[model samples]
Target: NTTPTAVADAGDATEKGGVANGSGGVVASGNVLTNDTDPDAGDTKTVTAIKFGATSGTLGSALAGTYGSLVLNASGAYSYAVNETNAAVQALRLSTNTLSEVFSYTMRDTAGATATANLTVTIHGANDAPVLAVQTTTQNATVGSAFSFVVPTTTFTDVDSGETLAYAATAADGTALPAWLSFNATTRTFSGTPTAGGTYGVKVTATDLGGLAANETFNIAVSVPGNTTPTAVADAGDATEKGGVANGSGGAVASGNVLTNDTDPDSGDTKTVTAVVFGATSGTLGSALAGTYGSLVLNASGAYSYAVNETNAAVQALRLSTNTLSEVFSYTMRDTAGATATANLTVTIHGANDAP
Candidate 1:
């Protein structure tokens, strides 16, 4: 008998003519085949394995040839044969534990046979738990001034297993954070007081159950104190006249000195008046005579004015004296201008000495 054996080249398969003797027939098996073309003459034929179906499959002995009952491994050992007259095509699924199955094979013949290839699979787990984000109210702050900030209460969660995470803050400025800040592990809330002010770059680190960690840093700016001017009050005794002299004659004049004018307590504006007297006097003598003066005469209105009386006998006698024989008297007029006024005076007598 003469038959055709299937051979696969790359993915395509072709049927090659096969020769046989009257009594002996050709058989294809395994990945390679050996056969006798002429039994009497000892001629031989060889066939290469063919690929079939969706993958690779074994060739069964149901299609007998000259070689006594050929055996094919179910573990994808041989190529597949085409269905000469097919009502419906069937495919073969490659199994494990075989080298032939390890090599991927595509379908070359759909009607005859089909096969399915095996594939290795892998799945990665979810990323480590998500880290909580750090929160802050301000980056810079003033010393002695208070700053308020809040840390979220929600803990980080892993996409795969969903577990709470832990966190801590590190002061990169080489100082410790104040204790006024509070922390709650259950709520994952963090609150703290920062007493010191400066450029503090702080880092907050968060860790999860899977040993994964994340960190964030923040900068703070602190300001110094503000400027303030001193207040001054002028002292009474410390104040001097426009000439830089203290409160005295060459400085401030006496409050009641008729000879000197007084000045304003602050502005130094002087209050002045001409010389004038306010008083009365009396006298008597055989020759010329003089008398001492008395207190000033003030009008009913309290205003001052000069007053002298010559109506008295003593005063008339003093005026009548003409001989060289004489009497002398002097008087001091006391100022009666009161505490608030100054008094000035000049005096002249109109009496003469008598001569015998």
Candidate 2:
């Protein structure tokens, strides 16, 4: 049998022109055998196998690629679909502005004789739109401190090769930022000291040279100045010591609101517990602190609980003495206007008879 001489043709594909205003990918399809031919008498052509670089395999129809998928029909027709998010492809496109994949296909004759030939597909680049990393952001500030936020350059991206982005900020309603706030297009930052109290919204836009743009919104709430210090009242509570000697097992818990009688001179101002410090140690939010004689758990809403350790030798000695003991804790509270107050809480433990 005479071996069929298989000739292959080159193909072209574009990495651009897909979804999201061409920020995605596209498909390239053509007949790879369009310029190929078999020099055998009465021989019919058939695609039997495919090979890419060092790898060789049977190709009844399709093969996958690093940046896309490739399919080859028996008739020699082929299609290559590019993956837009492929990092390698993006890097190549950005560096050299071009990409390509080359592979060889084996053609068989009706008589079973075959030959192989190569084909290459070149991918061209094009402009794509910029996309926002985050669509919206929220922030809070008080009048006493200057407010500032910088929009990261990486916040907006253009998948197309080596593209730069420009930024701008405005009111969400397409107006100017409030007088108290100023936006710097060059720095991609919002800065200024707020002079009033209210919720404000600003829209930020990132645009590429191709006129394609992406937008993000910032919702900022600034507090009014002239804050009045809030009062943190000294609180008191009582607990009965359990009649046991085991650590953490025989303890009595005392619960109360440390801010029950606290007040803020500013009208309509609300205060919340911000921190609790016992001596030189401080407790984390939503967590408990181990005190000298027990453990104290405090919440942001001013509610607190103290567990008295009946196993403490000093606490057990109280039963023989005055039959009582006292523990004090310090906590801080902040009002809506930013004023803060610190106070103490005293918890009394009454000794009870043990069942020795």
Candidate 3:
């Protein structure tokens, strides 16, 4: 057997061999196998490995038995054993599934040569589900407000390696969650805007691919602040209509207070008042405002008007105008929230006894 000799930095040097994840095996040899023959005789000498040993560097301590440490015998076969559930095993598995080591060997020829190379092994580990514990038992959120809280990873722990976790939130009592609150299962987070105020019972569950699961319950209380109902401004009765001399020009006129009486429950809320009705429910007041003798007209503020005498010239000349004009109407008050209140209005116009 023809053995190739190794040349170190200054010439003679040694190599160190290491265990491959305790599986017990030589990953690489210091020299490559080769064949040489005497020119005239045509005799060939091939590579023959003679010695294998740990020239330097100590193997890691064996966890249980000889898991992490490596063992190489003279024949070149190596061996090792590791517990699947060992913490070191889990750490190595999590870090890229590989362990680094070095080993040395000598060839079987006249010049024994040795070199060292890296040995790496991919480690297999058991998978497991994450375990969870509740860090917060109660939470508070403002009503009608958006909220988000990240579930801390420290709250959960996993014994087995290589696990990704998922989270889900539900009502402990099995009641459907309010439309406001929502959960992000992928991020293992809880988030949502609360619409109403109330004490809600909820449970958060964490699960892993290994089908391991844990749950924790907490009360989420939504605080509801006192709300005020809109104020419907009371209108002081309209001005008293003065009694005129039968059908005379000085007849008293009246109008409902439109803008002055409108109000909102919230001080900052917008409110609007509109005269929903101009005259009686059964009849149209006239073609337009003030068209009929007693036609009623509405202002932007909800104030209304009626003409005492809309009769023709001849009727006025004969003093035969409407003696009394009466009108009934409705007004609607609205707030920013679309809430509405309606009111009725009645007004009678007195005349001096001639009919138009």
Candidate 4:
């Protein structure tokens, strides 16, 4: 076989490897080939021969003469024209009939034209709910004291979307609530003063943008005060009698004689007297030495007493002589052995009852 050679006067080679004539290889009528439409002068007139046959045994055999010159269809599909000039083997894959064709096409070439298959995509819902976290100043407190705490602003969140949340707090027993209590919405904080004394149950619930909720509960206790009293004692030893009065005579009287006597000077408003009496001793009228008066009313000053006033009647008689006289009367006397001994008396002689 002889190979075709370019003539010395040929202008250029066509895409089919043919020498370019003056008008680019004779316009390629029927069996003629040309590169009149090629954008570059180096393009040749060499045709890309394609044969439609199964490349592997998995597909059926191909028809004889099913080889041809390659031509791109109007819809961008490829077609081969009949040709027997130079036979060649080529693989042809059928277009997929399922939705997987688009995937396959996309995987192979992302920039490829859209396929005619219908596609559906599914999306799943998020699997997260709101969460609640709690905090407080103290778990225990005394009555009428302050109990404070804070609920974090970010207490609840949607795990998938990360949206802001809302929340509120409630006391188990409304009657036992704190005296001064309030809540802040912006900061989600709680503060209050507990006026009552007892254990309180507190609960908080948080809600997310999706309306999902969560909650937490806790306890607080308050204590009460104690009791108080007083005590006293008396001093009985502080009360005592000072002393008794003494006789006015220069000599100590051996027998019961009329003498001035007084109660203890230090005696208070209330007084208690304790005494031992001697036996009776008296002297008759004008008698002097041996015996002394049995009884005497020497003086009566402040709440005084006389033995003659007693019902026993130990004295023989009672007498009062002067108003200002210190010794008013003298009666029978008593000995130490309690026997009547003597009587002493002084009788005044009046001149016909001197009335002046």
Mind giving the per-residue lDDT tens digits that candidate 2 earns over 168-210?
A: 8899779988888998899987899887665576788888866
> Which stretches of model 3 miss by more than 4 angstroms?
1-85, 91-124, 159-161, 226-356
Worst 10 residues of 3 by lDDT: 9-18
Error of 4 at 193 (Å): 1.3
lDDT of 4: 0.29
Cα-based lDDT at residue 263, candidate 3: 60
lDDT of 4 by residue, 1-356 (tens): 12222111111111111111111111111211221123333433322222223211111122232222333222222222222122121111011111111000000112221221111111112223454432331244445567666765654433434345676767743333344566665667767776654445566676655465666554454443331110111101010111122211121121222322211222231111111122222222333322122232221111112221112121112221121111222232221111111122332211111111
Each candidate's lDDT (Cα)? Answer: 0.30, 0.72, 0.45, 0.29
Worst 10 residues of 4 by lDDT: 98-107
Expressed as tens digits, the lDDT of each residue in 1-356 for candidate 1 is 23323333221111211111111112222332221122223323332232322323334433222111223443334433322122111111111111121222222222233322322111112223344332332243444556544445432333333444677766644355545444354454444445543344455566665466655444444433341211111111111111112211221211112223222232222232211221222211112222232122222222232222323333223322131111122211111211122223232223332222
The TM-score obtained by model 2 is: 0.58
| lDDT score, candidate 1 | 0.30
TM-score for predicted model 4 compared with the true structure: 0.28
Candidate 3 vs candidate 4, lDDT winner: 3
User: What is model 1's C-alpha RMSD?
Assistant: 51.8
**Candidate that beats the other on lDDT, 1 or 2, i.e. the better one:** 2
